[model samples]
Target: MAIIETRKLTKSYGSIQAVRGVDLSIEKGEIFGLLGPNGAGKTTTIGMLCTIIRPTSGSASIAGYDIVQRPSAVRSKVGIVFQDPTLDTILTGYENLELHARLYGITSALRKKRISEMLQLVDLTDRRNDLTRTYSGGMRRRLEMARGLLHRPAALFLDEPTLGLDPQTRARIWDYIRKMARKEQTTVILTTHYMEEADQVCDRVGIIDHGQIIALNAPGNLKESMGGDLVIIRTKEPPLVKIKALPYVREVKFNDGVLEITMKDAHLHLSGLLFMIPGVECVEIRVPTLSDVFIKLTGHDIRDDSAEDSGSWIDSVARYRQKGK
Candidate 1:
């Protein structure tokens, strides 16, 4: 049976539809990824399923209990790690876990054993008594992870779990998640902006764009279904209509001055495509990837909006609308 199931799940905030009709089925012992840009509804979807937010329309179930009709049961079956840290820094790690166990109504007899196992799983057994504020960013994340799993929920929800950690720390946390998921036979729902993380950790990913899933499949399968290698070119000005007319090209998109196209047997089409397009300065041909799949589906990269890349979005929107006209 599916550990989590949704049918046309949706959420709206006043004038904005944060999540549209979304259907998902996550099996037991599977690591599923919900990947998208900042406001593409990844968190809203997770929030609704976790019973933290009610869907404006549609239905969902966690661990076979309806989210709307049986919220308490759904909550009991799921554990969540939010993007921001929610731990009390003043308290010791052990104290936090103890509190979580008490709040969850974990039996007193099982509380101690469960907390110890969680701390060990996150590699915090030795420092379980230290004040959380004394811990490093990675350590604190690990502690939060441990607390989330303290009750041994059937489903684990991680919202950008390693957002601010260093590379080494992020990798370590991923290892712990994988280890715990396998050991506990838990279903994990991960939402992350990091492409490499989703590519590496998830058993399958649902690519959400503008509040709906545009693609869903295993990472490798998604890449393979993109239909052939990518042939990229840098040109002064891409003739969109002319390029679209090129035979053997499955898809063509011109973003900025970079022209990206997919073709069956890219090696066979690369030289011909480069020669046919005018003002070519550089050329590249490579295998498709998850990032490529996302760009193909959404027409934009999944990047943090705090960076320089954020400013270009206005111009992109303008161009997109003008093209629509």
Candidate 2:
């Protein structure tokens, strides 16, 4: 059954259309990724689905509840983790979860049991009594996740859950998310700009750009859609001007003395490339990654400043809240 579904969903802020005619369906217990560049309407979509923001046009449902007509029902089944931390600094990790349980109207007896289980699930049982202000970034993230799960929500919405954490912490959180999904059989809808995160954790990804979904498929399938292996060659001189003219190469792009070539057969063309361009410093042949696919489809780098800037204001707000506490 479809746990979440949308038809021509849209949201606008005066003259700016943040989301436009988006259609989506996510199955129960599936990990669905909303992948896109900044300003692509990913967060807006999540906000609408979670009933935090109303759509300007179109319709959506969460776990069989219409977002417009049955918002309380939809909200009851959905748990949201914003891109930034939402925990209270003065509250201990356990206290924060307890507060969430209360908000969800969980009974006192069940709340204690659920809190204990959630803390263990996130591997934070050892420090449950510590104030959130004293917790590490990863710990706080886990605590927030636990709080979201306190009510045993059927669908979880995580927006950039590991955005600014170090790589090690990010990996750890990824494992936690996967484990939670499997053990709880909860449908997960995550929005992120991180290519690796989507490739590694999502069952399928929907690529959004300019407030529209440009592509949707499994990570491997999406990469395959670009067609062929990728060969990255670095040299001291420009080669794209010549490489683009090669017989078998489909496309050639060069930036900062690095050439990216997309070809149907890398093995057949690699030797020819080397022979054609002498004194090449480095030649790297690899399968097309999510990043490569993103670039090919979008004609822009995935991690550019514009993408980073879209969420910087939220980050700044989070920092200010942290300082005030």
Candidate 3:
């Protein structure tokens, strides 16, 4: 049975539909990733599935319990780590986990055992007694993960879990998450805007855009779907002229002075491309990546939003219409 299921789930605030119809099914013991650009409804979907907000329509189930009908049961089976640190800065890591355990109604004895296990899981057993305020960003993130798992939840929800951590720290957290899934057989659903993170960690990924899922599949399958290798060309001249003329090129686009080429066989065409286009300074080739797939599908970089406005749904809608939606 699917550990988490959503059928046409949606959320709206007044007239603005924050989340459009979204359907997803996550199996047990799998790490599923929800990926999208900012304001693309990834958080809204997580909010609904986590029962932090009611969906405007449709339904969701967690661990066989309906989110709307059996909220308590569903909550009991799921743990969440939010994008922002939710830890109490003044409290020690152990204290925070203990408090979380109490909130979840974990037995006192089990709580103690779980806290110890969790601290060790995140490699924070030595720092368990230190106040969270004294911890580094990476340390606090690990502590938060430990606290979330204190109740032995069957499913874990991580919203941008490694957002601000350094690369090494992020890698360490990824190891812990993978280990937890293997050892505990826990199903994890993580939301991230980082394509590399999703590609590297998730067993399967759903690419969301404009409040809808644009693509969904295993990372390798999704990359394979793009068909063939990717060749990135850097040159002093504008790429449009050369890119349009290149043979065997499936698609070509230029952004920020970098030329991206998608081809069926990058190796077969590299020599030809170099010979054809002058002023080519550098060439890089690799298998299709999640970032490459995202760009190919969306025609825009995930992190390249220059819009200068922030407000509630009502304001966004009005602005969107005024600017011609």
- Candidate 3 ranges with C-alpha deviation above 4 Å: 231-284, 300-325
Worst 10 residues of 3 by lDDT: 300-309
TM-score of each: 0.78, 0.79, 0.78
Q: Model 2, 125-151: lDDT tens per residue? A: 999898899999999998888888778
Model 1 earns a TM-score of: 0.78
lDDT tens per residue, model 3, 1-325: 8888899999999998888999998898999999877788988899888889999999999988998999899888889999999899889988999889999999997888888998988899999898899999988888887777778788889999889888998888888889887877788899987788789899999988778888999998888887778788887675477667666777887876678777877767788777766687788998877876776665432224426344334334334444562
Off by over 4 Å in 1: 230-285, 300-325
C-alpha RMSD (angstroms) for model 2: 8.0
> At residue 97, what lDDT does model 1 achieve?
96
Compose the digit string of candidate 1's lDDT tens values, residues 151-270. Answer: 889999999998989899999989988998998888999998777788999999999877898898999889888798888898878777877887778898888898888887776777
Q: Which segments of model 2 are wrong by more than 4 Å?
A: 231-283, 300-325
> Which pairs clash (backbone N, Cα, C closer than 3 Å) in model 1?
none
User: Which residue pairs collide in model 3, if any?
Assistant: none
